[model samples]
Target: MTSSFLQGKKGLVIGIANDQSIAYGCAKAFRQQGAELAVTYLNEKARPHVQPLAEELGAEIFAPCNVSHPGELEGVFEAIEARWGKLDFLLHSIAFCPMDDLHGRVVDSSAEGFKTAMDVSCHSFIRMAKLAEPLMAEGGSLLAVSYYGAEKVVSHYNVMGPVKAALETTGRYLAAELGPQQIRVNILSPGPIMTRAASGIGHFDELMHHAEEHTPVRHLADINDVGHAAAFLASDAARSISATTFYIDGGYHAISG
Candidate 1:
């Protein structure tokens, strides 16, 4: 269970906010399974929280990448190109919606809010995939994080629902477009967890409680569960898998209630 499934693999991991971030969990799992990483911090304010985690994982390239900053996203790939030369996989776990839009109904979400959410949460993955394609000389994986709300209605999950829906669909299309080159693309849909990102969602505690009570597993899945699943999907072990909305949600997606 702890073999070097990803030994020798190298790639960038964007969106690590802190030790509790889903990206951090996945990066930790990737490291434990022998994959070297290039991690990013959003800004100087986030640097302190993310620096130690990146160092703990022995990340080879730790850079500041606020995707909204012009050229910052491209700069991440550039650094990776310089340090690793080639990449095997990438994990994208960033999403954003203005607090007002996140708390408002989808129908009432402002055009700017919807656009901003889609741009950060969905389009960013496509951008990363496009940048990563040339570097993945030997077939590789491109993973994005999603949520069950993308498929079904969840209380207080407003604008992100549509944003994630777009994100999942984009992954499928990227998988198709990049499949010929042997670049596998997929999305990870995890159940509610107390992430800083999730804190933006209104009444998040109720969402977590609902997931814990209703999900068949009788508990919410943690970031580590997402990490292990992400590691497997990104590893050679999942070479044949692509364009999937892989769920690490304790089977909550299976419940219709």
Candidate 2:
């Protein structure tokens, strides 16, 4: 792999639950581009899954961070300061909604489930950007993952669709707020991909097949494609771009039945 793009850069990639995760793809691409990395797993349950991937990437740090908890977020930044002192990029790939809420009608979604989804999927990015701002003394890039469901409704995407809408809006607000400091903020929306998180949503396989058949490209996005898009967005090449969401989907958003 050519290694000129991200040499000597340092970044924190949050929300990597396992090797198959989109965050994992971003982390790998960052490594290949010569960026040093740090990754966060949610809790003890995710350590074994995250550890090998961290080691494989030669990550400078690995820490536990549950974005829902303020203390965990504080501790993560503390560790980053103690180790790297400053950061060049931050990736927010965290999001969650109760399984029960995901498979049902949006009107049927419970209040608690809606709140949980918004907190984890939307508010967390806002909190992360606030926390990361001070640490990025030299200015930096911030990237978050979203989905087409945030706009056009996807069956079984219920509460998460709303959460992603909030997330995308948050990205725009942060982009505007941080632009003066030269910190770029953007969102990458990937088409249906087979990750563990997607597995939790009902009928994901059928959704994937449907996307493949309808999208102009006639195939699904590979993890690396999404990662490469992220790497570019987080790199100097994308310095002038912010307050925008880039679709990494294979033209799935443009087709009409």
Candidate 3:
């Protein structure tokens, strides 16, 4: 049954590269809850894959938004402003690490590679918050994806781990700054899901197996698990929840042995 918790609300979904993406899952949930959406693809190559999903979600504004690309992020906001004049929520799920840096020890990771990873994975979310602030005059929810590796040393997680830690910190600070305006910022740290982005991490199959065995649920959290939580955060139901990390890991983080 279609829900109305988000009825008459508008949201922007960034970082969906394909149907399997976490962003896609969130967008699907948002639409099911009756929220109007604006979705963006990273670039031309990503457009073909993401466009159909946007259409499926009935996104009214679909644009290209590779934050690394100059003006692209702003263009997406402009499109939203033109169509909806405001936003109720935003999701940021994109991250990156040069393969060499990602596979190497964090200590050996080059300064330039570290900078690039921080820029794309951590800083991009900050940029989006800046753009979304004005459009969220009525206040809004801003969500980003992080991981267990941010808080613990997952073997082979490498440079991206530190980058994710930064992301979590960034979210908290943004939440504190934006709270007075009623704009909530929160982070979702999902357990291993085999999205295209997750494929970059080394020994990912092993990580999945480990997560499956260790989690209290004895399985990984699927995209739907994430989608539902995101919907709640974006809704008024979670109005008091902000500046926190929701670990969608099926109790894996709870395991001690």
Candidate 4:
């Protein structure tokens, strides 16, 4: 069931750490739908894990984009400009908080940890958006990943919850700001699944089981599910869609108890 819905589109994907990463899943889907891709790895340590996936995706440009690193993000965009001259879409799927801060109460999180979380998980997207803006001269989509905890209280999702909330709000503002340029921005919030990042969360198994049990569909979304949504939103088919959040959770977010 491969489709050409995304044929001729060119996109950049950031935050792919390994095969199980949501970024990998979405990038896979985009390739399946016939889009050209440029993918980023975090660093040399992450390069081995991510480069193989980038090869599989047939990415035309593979570069490093450690947003925290002084000039890495800019270098990535510079590579994109040299290689493709333009970008049709961009995906920001990275988030982080030190495990200590993540497992502790939000109020107890150190100022440094909070700032780090916000800078990486939230502010990074803003930076990405700014870098991706001029490259998207033809009006394109910008997307990022989110979680239910951003809007509600989810155990073990402390600092990231607020960080993700900031990300969602940032998406809206970027959408409004970039809409005039025909650049669309949106957020995708998925239920718990065992991502490498998720494994860092305290009581994550309990969280996953609880989500599956309480979810009306009696299951949780895998990376593929989120990927398909990302594919749809990134396509020309979703041209009119922007500045919104799509929950990929299986009815769990709607449950009362």
- Candidate 3 vs. true structure, TM-score: 0.98
TM-score, one value per model = 0.98, 0.97, 0.98, 0.98
lDDT per residue, candidate 2, 16-82, as tens digits? Answer: 8887899999999999998999888898999999999999999888889997776998888888889
Tens-digit lDDT track of model 4 for 1-257: 35599988899999899989998889988999999999999889999999888898889999988899999999989998998889999899998898789999999999999999999998999998999999999999999999999999888888888999999999999999999999999999999979899999989999999999999999899999999999999998999999999999998889975
Worst 10 residues of 4 by lDDT: 1-10
Using lDDT as the measure, which candidate wins? 3
What's the lDDT for residue 177 in model 4?
99
Return the lDDT, model 1, position 179.
Answer: 96
What's the residue-level lDDT of 110 in candidate 4?
96
lDDT score of model 4? 0.92
Question: lDDT (0-100) at residue 226 of candidate 2?
Answer: 91
Off by over 4 Å in 1: 1-3
RMSD of each: 1.3, 1.2, 1.0, 1.2
lDDT per residue for candidate 3 within 114-148, as digits (tens), equals 99999999999999999999999989999999999
Query: What lDDT is obtained when candidate 3 is compared to the true structure?
Result: 0.93
Which model is ahead, 1 or 2, in terms of TM-score?
Answer: 1
* Residue 59, candidate 2: alpha-carbon lDDT: 85
